[model samples]
Target: MKKWFSSAIVFTVLAVLVAGCAGGNTKSGTSESVDANKGEKKPVIKILQNKIEITDKVKAMVADYNAYNPDVVVEVQVVKDYLTMLKTRFASGDAPDIFTTAGYNPMASWSDKLVDLSNEPWMGSVSPLTIEGMTMNGQKMGFPLAFEGFGVVYNKDLFAQAGIDTPPTTFSELKAAAEKLKAAGIKPYKEAYQEGFPLYHILNLGFAYEQDPLATLAKLEKQEMKLADLPFLNNVFDVLDLGMKYGEGQESLGVSYDSQVSDFATGKIAMINNGVWTIDPITKVNADINIGMFALPLTDNAEETKMPISVPGYYVINKDSKHVEESKKFLSWLHENGEKYLVDSFKFFPAFTDIKATDDLGPLAKDMAAYVESGKGITWTQSAWPVGYREDTVKRIQAYIGGQGDREQTIAELQKDWDNRVNK
Candidate 1:
């Protein structure tokens, strides 16, 4: 811990002051659960995570951990809209013992309420990038869940069938490839416009492609820069335009995530804008499908193209909880003993430097890991965007795609929303 992060844990000795503190303790599941046979009570560690995809596996891991250590119990609750629900939980004095935070701006907002895990033993084994993302005021506040990569997940067989030997690495090449795919009677792209995430990824690339993404983000935060003012912001839409032209046109707005991934799996489309997390779902649909991933280029410069690799979320313990130590214990246990669940069961790529990803998570993981190892990956800029920006911006872009507004109108609305919401 000293070698990695030497900061000491500053325990919150003072009781948390809230309107309903007693109710908070009980509702957070920090209260002890009595064991009938032993006539003893076990403290509960409640975790509220956002990834609904891994809910079942997380429950299985919790069961294993509880069985291994009978004196303590751990429970996990998965939610779809995590940030809104997390804020509601804290506002109602019902915060979980441990909850997920995406770090950066969000972590800064919740820093005072998070326990200091700077001196945790496992802290030494994790990646420096993970530490950088989760740290606040020189203190490590969260345990990184795993590394995730997102871009254009494409079908290799379709590319080969189209005579495209080399996958696109630049905006020009991507358009050319799309042309080839279309000429080969293959639908080039499936824009899952029904989902906010894919569209958010496009907008995020506008910032990520900037010379200094953080400085650009600061400008946007301070209203010194607007989304339309971005040099490559139009280029972001150029990529989306390829999808709009070659994909299902306006009907792409009706393509849900499940249907998009399913279509990609069935070779109905050559590529889709998604992440490595979709591998399992796609495999479930078509195990024999050959696939690969590439960076979603935002510019004609090949040098600027890179995959977006990030720690999607991190686990932060509630400083206000009575079972803070127990929550820490559970995290430590998971880090030390949950390799099987993390790798095989959850199909996660370990974010820890010392812990190798033993099983091949998927083809997308392989491509992402290569980029990560080669320093050709970019950080997720949306993590630092305003909390509600994605949801609002996604709708704004969707409205444009749906013919409710033009591109100029979409940009104006997004900028107006940012000005209204950034400071709030």
Candidate 2:
């Protein structure tokens, strides 16, 4: 895993040639339409992204971009099961000019299809750690959307009400803290099992706890490791067990992300195993909710605790799109003027060093940044896992947590899935 502490990737550009790259098939008329009144063609740059939570905000941002650049029309499309749908769009020859993909393996899968962005003006200002996930064979093929970290976020006032002095950093302490919160009549956790992604973060802890998490993941990719053979996994399952035992009960399977954030924001729940991304929705629900974040300790070894922090996703241009240059220009404009939206509208920790994260980015971001600064942040190992792995893995986990299978059975199923995914 790359440590993102204070390192920078400084490439002094003699001058930013705001000109377009020289190659690629430009299907001119296909991406632009003649305005009926003016008889003028206005190019359209379509963007397809996966983050449903920020669909509106992204659309709003695009509106602002369109207003600023009236010559081009930038359209945003947010989809569920983004990768699968994106593949479908590509197969149908309806691919967007710009799209989003998670870093590492997912980015690698689409590297050939992406525009090489190594020389993009924004490249100089981005953190090397942010760039690392998007680079393949020396070509930077993707632009990082933001830096993100996840673990456990807790309500500070609720903790105080429960007489808990400090955030727990170990499984035993976590269990004790949960008990205290429960005793005080606060819901210990609002586990959002309805969405497979949150449980993915939980299951990912199994890999993140390994001595060499990325190496261990690579072993699995090469069929040299099995989920059951990995140590500290029982602790990962224990954390899940603890969440279900002390959380909002089996009904948690129906708890949507919105409700989970709202519950925590309103003091209905004291803690939740989520990420800094929740800060935006949380502030909208209740701006004054005092909260803090800490690594979800996977075992009794407090020393092993670290927040999983990495570039959650990236924006890449389709190399073959007719609007490749337009897409690049749009991305450039967004990043150059996006600091305000990134901080205020998106509640993001800017991946680019030029955009500073302000003090008001919420306690979760601040605490996660501290972890990154202290070199205690770990990789989001799932980013390197097989594309579409989480949807299946989280389902099996939900089954086990729902009492549909034994732990061994679930692990076996997980291993079988990995083998089939790798081989097929």
Candidate 3:
């Protein structure tokens, strides 16, 4: 099934690119005619997305919008995987008029294909850092749909059983707590390194502590600072060593994402270092389970801080699109109403200030929301790494975790690769 889905996604992406190029001239003419028609006719907008399963509540909201705006028809094309489909479409220059643009690093790779939405009315509703990461050479390329934070998501019920009352505030405290939980017959931490990204995510938490890590990276590229001189990288090694010490017996390399979450939800593990979206999977296991979250602890010498987070994904308009105005209108609506739909139906936490929390939000989600409101969180490091460097770093971390090499040698190799990419 997975192979079939992957193939289908590849085929659909290729088809979209081919169709876009072949029909370019036709679309140009149609766009002019549509603009001439103005308010007299409805505009049909195409949306490319991977998430197709809209809850009934979201469907109702769309239905309501359709009733009010009979002239606009929203067509959603669902793909199986975001990155592969986007890469295929982008290479063909047959990309969708509107699609997701927020991701680690490669966001800049698509800069030429995206529209500048800096002056959009709804721009203020999203985080500026999110905009910064997606922007290339000063052009805003993506619109954030929701925000997320990664941390220690723990079961409150398990904590109570262990006689713990509050979330750990520091790394040492977390280590002590883990020991206590383990003594109570619980796995202290559960993480999956099968997909490799989780290992890099651990490093990202450490990078959040540096002052303008991304900007520093840009300077490092220009030979202003040595990559080895960065303090955050040292912090990353520190945390990984700590995690490795605690998760000694667990086969991190063998664990799949499903098994990791399942272990936590089934009460086999007391905590998991994961993002806010974990609630979705956890709820599927036991809706009554009580979950809580705390920020990843900062370095001992640094002041207490929360890791950077952003709207986990974004919506970007195609710069060369024929339906630019119409696409922008739809995006504006999405920025305003889409957030509410996502939060209410999918339990998403909106990045927008105007949106209120849904009643059904878990306690941990509420805490994350409050943390963001207080301006405590930093943007995720993966979002800012150079496009090619990001994946390379992940692969290196995965190999390191699986015991492919010693830590110093692995990091030095990665540092060299990162420097080469940045300098290039």
Q: What ordering of candidates by TM-score runs from best to worst?
A: 1, 2, 3
| Positional deviation of residue 159's Cα in model 1 after best superposition, in angstroms | 0.9
Residues 1-424, model 3: lDDT tens digits: 1121111100000011101211111232233213234535445555566564443444455455556655555444556676798678767766667777565466677777778888999876654445555667877667766666677788888888877788877767777787888778776776676766666677776555666666776676677876567776776665666566667433776777799888888888788777776777788898888888877775653245564465556777888777788899877776677546656655666645566556476776777755555555665667667667777887887777777877678878887887788768
Q: RMSD of model 3, in Å?
A: 8.4
Better of 2 and 3 by lDDT: 2
Please give, for residues 1-424, the per-residue lDDT of candidate 2 as tens digits.
4444436321110101111111122233257755666768788777777656655666677667767876777766666677787899899888888888777888898889999999999988887777668988899988776777778889999999999999888889999999998898888988998888888888888888787887898888887878888897777778888888998667778888888888888889888898877777787889888888889988777777877777777788999999888899987887887567775676667778888777766677777777677677677778877876877798898888788888888889888888877777
TM-score for candidate 1, please give it.
0.89
Q: What is the model-wide C-alpha lDDT for candidate 1? A: 0.76
Considering every candidate listed, which one attains the maximal TM-score?
1
Worst 10 residues of 1 by lDDT: 9-18
Query: How does candidate 2 fare on TM-score?
Result: 0.87
Clashes found in each candidate (C-alpha, N, C closer than 3 A): 0, 0, 6
Q: Extract clashing residue pairs from model 2.
A: none
TM-score comparison, 1 vs 3, better candidate: 1
How much lDDT does each candidate structure score? 0.76, 0.77, 0.64
